[model samples]
Target: MRIGLFVACITDSLYPATARATVRVLERLGHTVVYPAAQTCCGQVHYTSGYRREAASLAGRFADVFSGCELVVTPSASCAAMVRTGYPRLAAREPRAADAPRVLELSEFLVDVAGVTDVGAHFPHRVTYHPTCHALRSLDVGDRPLRLLRAVRGLELAELPAADECCGFGTTFAWKNADTSVAIVADKIRHIGATGADVVCALDDACLTQIDGALSRLRGGVRALHLAEILAAGDPAGDR
Candidate 1:
C-alpha cells in the first residue's frame, strides 16, 4: 500500500518529529510512504479567517498536488477536516477542484483503511489522550486513537477528565480571543493535572502546543505527545 504523507503546515514547521513518526509507523506496517514536495498549507486558516479567494486558490493547489496519490494521510485532524469538508465548499465553482483527493487523519487511515490497530509499538509510559475539537466533532475519529494506544505493549492508558472539552486552541481563536482562550485552557490544564499521567497525547499539533505550553509554564511535568509518536515508539524508554 502506497501512502502520501500530507505534513500540514504546523506539523511540518514545528512538529517535524510527528511527520517522521508517521512515516516510521506506516513503513513499519510495510506501507510505502511518498512525500510530495509541492505540498503546502491546506488554506484552512485562510478559509476560516474569511479569505475565500486566497483559500480557494490554495484549495486548487492542494487538489493539484495529491489528486493522483493512492491515499493521503495526515497527522493533523483539523487539516484533514479542511481537505475533506472545507475544500469542496471553497472550490465549488471549479468542478475539477471540487473533486480533491481523499484525505484521512492518521488514526482513521490505520483503523479504517489499513484495518490494523496494533502496529507493534512499545512505549512504557502512563498516558492520557486529549481528543482535539476537529478530531472529536469535525472528524469524529472516535475511539480509533484510544484503540491504538490500548494496543501499545507497555503503555498504560488513563482516561482524561472532561476528555471532550476543547483545549482552547480553536485555530485563530487562541489569538483573537486571547483572554477567553487562556481561561478555557486553564480549566483544561487543571483537568489534565488530575489525570496524573506522565504524558498527554492528541492528534493535532495545534492543541498539543496549546496544552503543552500551559503545562510547561507551570512546570506541570506532563509532556504533550502526538498519537503518531506514540504509535511509532519502539524504545522502552521512549523518546523524551
Candidate 2:
C-alpha cells in the first residue's frame, strides 16, 4: 500500500524524529511511505480554539494534499482524531469533508489496516503507556497500542495507575486553564511515578510533552517516548 504520511504540525516542528521513526517502521514492513510536504496543521488547534473558518480552510488543504493517496497515516493520535472526527464538523460545507474518513492514527493503521501488531521493535526498558484522551475516547484505539507494545522483544509493559485519565494537554485547555491543567497533570505524574516505569509511551506527542515536562520539573527519572520511536528502537538504520 502507498501510505501518505501526514506529519502533523507539532511532529513536523518539535518532534521530527517521531515522524522519521514512523517512516522507518512502515518501510521495514514493506509498505511504501510517502511524505506529503504540502501537508500542514490539521486545523485541530484552530477548530478546538473556535476558529472555525481558519480550521475549515486548513481541513480543505489537508484533504487536497493527500487526495491521491490510498491511505493516510499519522503518528500523532490527536491530529488523526482531528482529521477523522473534527474535520467533518469543521469542513461540513467543503467538498473535502469525505476525506476525513481516510485519515488513521498510527496504531489504528498499523494494527487494523496493516494487520500487524509486532513491528520488530526491541526496547529493554520498563515502559508505561498513557492513552491520550483523543486516542482513547475519540479515536477509540483501545488495546491496539498495547498489543503492539506487548509484541516488542525486550519491552516490559507496566500497567499505569489510572491509565485512562487525561494528561491535561487539551491543546488550548492548558493555556486557558493553567491551574486545572497543572493539577490534573500532577495527578497523572503521581500515577506514572507509582508505575515505576523508566519510560512513558503514547501515540500523541502533545500528551507526552505535558507528561514529560512535569517529569522534568519534578526531577523524576521517567522519560517520555513516542510509540513510533519505541517501535523503531532496534532498527540499525533508523534514527535513535
Candidate 3:
C-alpha cells in the first residue's frame, strides 16, 4: 500500500526521531511511504483552543494536501483524532472541504489495516505503555499498541498503574491549568515509576513530552519513547 505519512507538527519539530522511526517501520513492512510536502497541522491546537475559524481553514488545507492518498497515517494519536473526528465538523459547511483523507493512527493502520501485529522489533528492556487520553478515549485504539509490543522480541511489557489516566498534556490545557496539569502528571509519573520499567511508551508525543518532563525533573530514570521508535528497534538501519 502507498501510505501518505502525515507527520504532525509536534513529531516533525520536537520528535523527529519518531517520524523517522515511523518511516523505517512502515518501509520494513514492505509498504511505500510517501511524505506530502504540503501537509501541515491537523488544526487540533486551534480547534481545541476555540479558534474555529483558523482551525477550519487549516483543516481544509490538510484535506487538500493529502487529497489523493488512499490512506493517511500519523504517529501522533492526538493529531489523527483531530483529523478523523474534528475535520468533518470543522469543514461541514465548505463544499471543497467535504471530503477528508482516511486518516489512521500508526497502530490503527498497522493492526487493523495492515493486519500485522509484529513488525519484527527487538528491545531488550522492561517497558510500560501509558495510553494517552486521545488514544484511549478519543481514538479508542484499545490494546493495539500492547498487542504489537507483546510480539516484540526480547521486550517485556509491564502494565502501567492507572494506564488510562491522562498525562495532563491536553495541548493548551497543560499551559493554561498549570497546577492541575502538574498534579495529574505527577500521579502518572508515580504510576510509571511503580512499574519498574526502563521506558514508558505512548502513541502521542504530547503525552510523552508531559511524562518525560516529570520523569526528568524528578530523575525517575524512566525514558519516554514513542511506539514507532520502540517498534523501529532491531532494524538494519538501527533504532532512531
Return the top candidate by TM-score. 3
Clashes of 2: 0
Pull out the clashing pairs in model 2: none
Residue lDDT tens for model 1, 85-194: 88778767555558678899999999999999999898899999999999999899999999999999899998999999999989899999999999999999999889
User: Which segments of candidate 3 are over 4 A away from where they belong?
Assistant: none
> So what's the TM-score on candidate 2?
0.97
lDDT of 2 by residue, 1-240 (tens): 899998877788799999999999999999999987787788889988888888888888888888888788899888888877887786566657567538888889889988999999988999999999999999899999999999998999999999999999899999999999999999999999998999999998888888899999988788899999999989997635
lDDT per residue, candidate 3, 169-230, as tens digits? 89999999999999999999889888999999999998899999999998857899999999
Each prediction's TM-score against the native? Answer: 0.96, 0.97, 0.98
Give the lDDT ranking, best first: 1, 3, 2
Clashes of each: 0, 0, 0
TM-score of 3: 0.98
